[model samples]
Target: MINLSIEEVLKYERGEVCNEEDCKQMTLERSQSNIFMAVVLRENNKLIGHIYFNQTVPFEFLTWEIGYIFNQRYYGNGYATEASRRVLQYGFEELKAHRIIAMCNPENASSWRLLERLLMRKEGQPIWHNANQYAILADEWQRNNE
Candidate 1:
């Protein structure tokens, strides 16, 4: 996997690049906010990706939206699925979340399939970000796991 190009990684993921200061500020903001939490996905002690969860909106403590990205090289080895499953458990059990949701670019078939495989039901119409939304209730997660 490519190593150490912050601008390139940001451009690839967010369609924009940031300078070092902006990156540091963003990290600081996330760190200061108790509402957002992130977990790293690693393989053999190397970082492969990140999975993040945060309240869908401030004051909506029982609901969360999850987002993730992985290096292109690790795209099809089931790392996303494994990491997401564990994160979903953390959301429901540790965070006491009642619902967990996710969204992806409408054309991202792999992500849609991954969400479905995790048992999240597709919901609502597509939004302005051109993303399709999917969600799973805590009860649903529990029943399925049991």
Candidate 2:
């Protein structure tokens, strides 16, 4: 398991109350959720970003939902794409997940491109949330891999 400092958690929380106590509680809760994995990215020993995957039951579909955050300085560096690729490989090969899904704001064109490059299908029209939805099936991923 990866470890994160209280200070680092505070920074990532983005102004939320991420005190030591809260961090401990959150860490314990996260530990209990065996279906998720969180990874921290470091450069020059400095924490720069983090990503996570969680298994969810979305409607009739059982899927893995991915979410990530990066330090502002790390944007446009392709780290998101590489990290997401690694996660997808793990999800398919190791976790044996049948589906994976990701979503982003319609205005976030970069995310759309990354998803396309990974060969994930667009599915239906955007679902209203804080952002639009995109998804890929196990068959779609397998065909692309072949």
TM-score top scorer: 1
Candidate 2 lDDT over residue span 1-146, tens digit each: 12243343334233354555765676578657864444445645554555668788663565798766555556688887888888888877787888998866666676678888788867656555546667877777778788
List CA RMSD, all candidates.
Answer: 3.7, 5.0
Model 1, residue 133: distance off in Å is: 0.9
Off by over 4 Å in 2: 1-45, 58-61, 127-130
**Per-residue error (Å), model 1, residue 2:** 5.9
Question: Where's the lowest-lDDT run of ten residues in candidate 2?
Answer: 1-10
lDDT of each: 0.74, 0.67
Count clashing residue pairs in model 1. Answer: 0
Give a tens-digit lDDT track for model 1, residues 1-146. Answer: 22113543433245455556765566567657764444445545665666677777654658888877665667788988998998899889998899999987667777888999999988976757677889999999999999
Candidate 1 — which residues are off by over 4 angstroms?
Answer: 1-13, 17-43, 58-61
